[model samples]
Target: MSMSLRRRSGHGARLGAAGLLTFAALAGTGAAHADVAAPRALPAGCSGTSPITCHYAVAPGNYDVTVSLGGAASAGQTEMWVEARRLMLPATRTAAGSVATYSFTVNVRQPEGQPTGQGGTGNPGLNIRFTGSNPQVSAVSVKPAPQPLVAYLAGDSTVCDQPSAPYTGWGQVITTAVRPGAVIANYADSGESSGSFLSNAALFPALLSKIRANDPVFIQLGHNDKQTSASAYRNNLDTMISRVRAKGGVPVLVTPPVRRLFDGNRLTPTALHVNGVGVNLPAEMRAVGTAQRVPVIDLTAKSKALVESLGTSASAQLFLRSSVDGVTDNTHFSQYGATRIGELLLQGIREQRLSLAAYLR
Candidate 1:
């Protein structure tokens, strides 16, 4: 009935009671209860319009999710008055020829005292069933409450919007590991920054226009912040952060990616970075953030460590393919490698020890 169901309000979760939320870590296993996405929004079939809340989500698999109405002697049968139609989804998210199954649930309720809505009468409920290959297996379930949000990411080129193609920055890594659903949105561009992201006459303002309360902003710059220590690009960190905070948005800063180069003795993060690849920027950005008392995501340091761990031979697979002209492929990541970084980002979230694991689905 309400966004916060009083009964499902507690943080505690039931393993098989049709409502346990699971946030997928690197494993990308079955999604958690809270982190799972709702099937879709449709007209309510339940009679009356008293604002009922639906608890439903599908985990990763090929599923045959179905909904039907029924009731027990203790109560009435679930009526379809309020529900326009029961949803039935076919297999998705798994291998095509492989047999698999998926499941989801819908919970209906009234706040007691309000006029009953469709399916709100008695203890009437919908019975969701599944039948496919391997009908019986180990699975988890739980109902989850909405999460409180407190951060946002805003940047350009390397740390902004997640480009669908032409492999680019690692910003998506942060979001993939930290939360799911509406928890994060990337507003970065391939060649934007504090100034260009804001002014560019056609950029900045439009991006910041949609941010809301407690939604912290994360900034990553260096390649474009310029090498100078006091350029408007570099100097604006605090001012930009303050302006964001004044608007009730928290602010975070991230270092740029390390240049894909090898020192005579070891990996040199600060080397030739063409193709607008902003290597070493994140590392430098992290420094200013430390002094400013702002949170910092050391992607540069972390990425450097990742490259070092994989070694240049194995790590090169993560970067864009090198064509003649070097293809300007200095900082961007490959898809397979991007997933790996996403896994690491989740580890970072855990290391930071924030209350964000609940959003992992």
Candidate 2:
């Protein structure tokens, strides 16, 4: 769906002194009963609407985080994203003088801190970001997690953690669906075909080296695999599944989401993810899943149903349209669309009876 976009820089708007006072007062008042106590004076950097980032210089690893949401004088709504824009919380609305506490696990690494993706480097530590109509933060806590169910994602741009706004990937938003004790490490990068993922040192090799027993490795490619032969595509997927199995990890196949291409009321074969050589990539992935006895999340089918149901014009909200971002990207998703896809992924996990489903929020 994309090549790597620019990484988010540390520079962003900051809250004014009065705004800080408002946050401090609201945060202090809510500290008594909250699980993660709010600081009497919230450190600077919390912004109003633009993303406010707070970085903790910690080593690369999984950390359990608890955040107290809401501190604005009036009602506020907020969303949280960790390193590389991994959505840990969706838009949460809070009334005036109210605080909502949420906890989740985040995997932080060096360079970009993201599980995978080559892009602008990340600062050394954990970066917690807040963004929404009226973003707010009362308190924040980070503790190294002893162990957490790590869900590893591997795929193309459609499934990677998109670095910027408007153009979102399902992997970036799926973290919001799970609670603590589970962390999603997205290694999926833009422009990666199945073969490239398997061969890329920064991708599959790094992912394989980190796999623990019972870990779920979700693989979804095909957006860039359009030129790959059917046999090679299937073989690459099989090899990836086998490698995960060899590492005592479980492999789950996810079909690539459909493009926003439509012909009249129905979608065209190309939009449905048929390859340049006339192969249905999703169907091939399904065949591999069946042959390997791996669970397959049919995102292609699910997304197709969703897009066709909405039809051409209405479905623009499900993608990055020029109206919103000054650019129409039929392949990439907006935040709302990514959130929906994340929900669909959660549903697929439940349907497959994945152990990770137990930790979903």
Residue-wise C-alpha lDDT for candidate 1, range 194-228, written one tens digit per residue:
56555553333533554567565667655565543
Error of 1 at 37 (Å): 24
Global lDDT scores for all candidate models: 0.41, 0.76
Superposed model 2: Cα runs more than 4 Å off = 1-40, 43-51, 71-74, 113-118
Error of 1 at 81 (Å): 34
How much is the lDDT of residue 120 in candidate 1? Answer: 29
Best by lDDT: 2
Q: Where is model 1 more than 4 Å wrong at Cα?
A: 1-28, 31-151, 160-166, 173-182, 201-203, 226-228, 269-284, 322-328, 354-358
Model 2 vs. true fold: TM: 0.85
lDDT of 2: 0.76
What is the TM-score (0 to 1) of candidate 1? 0.54
